[model samples]
Target: MRPTGVQPIPLASALGRIGLAGSGIRADLPLVSGITLDSRSVQHGDVYAALQGGTRHGADFAAAAVRSGAVAILTDEAGAELYAQAPAAAGSDVPVVVVPDPRRAVGPLAGVIFGTTDRDGAAPALFGVTGTNGKTTTTYFLDALLEALGRSTGLIGTIEIRAGREAIPSALTTPESPQVHSLLALMHERGIDAASMEVSSHALEFGRVDGVRFEVAGFTNLTQDHLDLHGTMEDYFAAKATLFTPERCRRAVVLVDDPWGRRLAAAAEVPVLRLRTEPADEGDDVADWTVADVEPSGLGHSFALVGVSGERLVLRCGLPGGFNVSNAALATIMVLASGVRLDELQHALDRHDPFTTEVPGRMQLVGEEPASIVDFAHNPDALERTLASVRRPGGRVISVFGATGQRDESKRAVMGAVGARLSDILIVTDDDPHDEDDAVIRRAVRQGAEAAVQEEELACEVLEIFPRGAAIDRAVARATPADTVIVAGRGHEVWQEVRGVDVPLDDRVELRAALTRYGFSVLSAPRIES
Candidate 1:
């Protein structure tokens, strides 16, 4: 989505700004108005970034991009060769700007081409949140808090991208660099004062956020997830740490509850404000802000942010669980790091109650009688926290979840064990097989649950059900009025991929219908269907 009213720059000038002017073997250059990575989305006067994929070269579609009115082709040496051989390059005068690493170059190119570069203060003040979990909720909290402070804000995260009231569904947690700059430019055009974004490890590693400086970067806790991409936890942590550099962000607010957060605070290249949501030892270095005097409110917690300098601010969140407290704390501290005064923020909180904003599919409530919930807690740590949080003193916790195919297979067993240990009834089901055999994925998860029940002599009942809709129905059918039925894994996702095909499956809709069918009263929020 390119912003309107930006003056176009010469293709040669855009390449020169990114240090690729003389290093290119190219043809006639034209004025470049926009940039895109996908050939299908190319517009008139756009530079088509032909990158190499895992199995296919993007240059294979060079002809299509040219036909769609691409003024230039941005590619690497290999991509240049492929484009030269492409049929569209035989007599085409389109310029081919070659770079050593096109992935990293796309950011600078897009920034320069779209007039969103650092030469002018054009982009909004960006707040970035990164971690294994809590990223989505924290971004939502950031947006809400910014709005409460009287700033028109934009949001870019797992669920959607927003510019004021308009929203478009998100395809990635962090989009490709071209689209990122384009969105930032669009937000600036629409007069959005601030923005909050979720920066994933994949985004950092793949240079998706290159050349975009955040006003204040935030660090949530790191856990064991996405090992398939990083290959190790250390690598994953390093990737997230890159976002805190002085070149990337002006300042940082880190949650020091875990060793990872503490390490990040000590290692960040920018000024840091250490925040702790849980208790710390007496000898430990005092955090810049600590969450204190926590008490349960309606479906949430009211807490005070006590600063090291005798500053105390009261804040409350409508989201449940101890983790949400951490999330809310992180959002508040990041806003303060961006220079919001205590009294100003308190006034907003008192009037708007922004932290209590509902983050869809994080810990979403669907019903009341049986206490139905739908969440995206696929990883082991998230599963454990969610299962423990949803438990009632006298009622049972019934969970229906499964592992996603081709993503950190080692966590499947761990998640299964966590579910079995914490839940009274664990029902294993399919979660987006994505070209892998569904039965094989289910077997591994079920085996882990069965093993936990046998080794620990747990009183939990384990069941394996396929075709998740039936599993959801079975979970509701077996639950009593006191039991809490949690449908975990695919939260807010409307499609379930099986053998490369997307099938319609929204957990909220499924849970709502099942709860209504079983005589349980569901929430009257019409946004659930939307």
Candidate 2:
């Protein structure tokens, strides 16, 4: 027998279960206790999943994995061949389990090894949200809703992974196949009743979400993003549509606020519950679930979601933007779809200060005197919403934003034009140049903003501040108490990716420092009780 929670499966049994081409697989292999793709994280009695990657092959590290106590080498056919020919084969009795498509195989393999195939009542209910924007906030809202209902929830997204209350920093929006299964198993063991995950387009395309099944998969609006990976909007939409397939998720809630979302709904095989943000916009029948009467006041917004049944529910959110209203509405429908009692969700919303629902670095107010707001609005759509949502009272909106390097360069000019249209003072700063020429990226955005100002005859003052911290300083120093400073891009990220190095540079922390320099503090403001 294995340990308490770990139920080890015989290597032969698991291989036969997944129906992979087991050409060179040994019949009498050891019972594997765990599975891992990373060689450094391998342990005794674990199956080392060697994969063929874009940049490098996992077979190259088979020796390290074996040395780290990997019992068997589970890899693709090519990887298996490489492992057999390599020096690691010498004196190694480990069986090389060959599979044609190891990427897809890993998910099922992980599911069997971890005992998550039986995602029944005892298992935590899974919720997955995917889109170009609002996925993070939507996941956060669903997690918060469950937490308010007195249920411990695990959260998985770009910022971090939380197994109940345990927070582990994460790299990808959806972690690797093995890690995802392991995290789900851990969440199950920890007594979490539900989990909310942000599924990225890259994750879908790369098969990161292969093995798991979501109880309710949600879609935020898709816009111009991740073009570098998908190459085109159609490909990106196709990648996102895979999540809504009947094989992937049981139910889905789609916000048909954009054309891409409408396309997703039309082709989705699974039963989909639709939602519309600007339901009263007329002409186009968006969705029966209409979000109307949106009032953005005092760092939060409240809206009524009228479902297809003509039932109306009013909910408030701390986050700004019509985009966030869509996120909140989608999250609500997801909660209801997950079979949570609707009254419980309503009670949670009614009793709790919905504004107190904490989403870090997303329209996060570091200082309220001059009203400093930091958001992870990287793309053109997000920037448009963030700039539009933030109000300046009697003063003007001073927006500090920049485009990221090596990703969807087409959006840079559009972002520049939108930023120019929204802000009275626009500062184009550096945001994660990541080995690409920072000057070139900044010039593209700045030129677009400058040209837009000239073309549209806008009075916005545009400036190029290479370093982000200086941009924060300049924006803060120029703004008064009535003015609002909206910092877009790189919201919750702790470090700024520059030249392949993640330097410690958090926008919220830097923005706070800038606010302190200007003699403004959040603590100095009056607090409102929910």
Q: Which stretches of candidate 1 lie over 4 Å from their true place?
A: 25-28, 281-283, 525-530
Q: Each candidate's lDDT (Cα)?
A: 0.90, 0.84
lDDT of 2 by residue, 106-210 (tens): 888888788776688435889999998888888888888888778889998987889877787777888988888888888888888899999999889888888
TM-score of each predicted structure versus truth: 0.98, 0.95
- Candidate with the greatest TM-score versus the true structure: 1
Model 1: pairs clashing at backbone N, Cα or C within 3 Å: none
Candidate 1 residues 1-530, lDDT tens each? 66997788888877788787775444358888998889999999899999999799898887899999998888888988998987668998887877889889898888887767772469889999999999999999999999999999999999999988999889999999999899899988998889999999999999999888899999999999999999999999999999999878999999998889999999999999999998997767789999999999987899999999989999999987889999999999999999998899999989999988878788988887788888999899899889988887689999999999988899988888999999899999999999889999999999999999999999999999979999999999999998999999989898999998999889998898888888888886434332
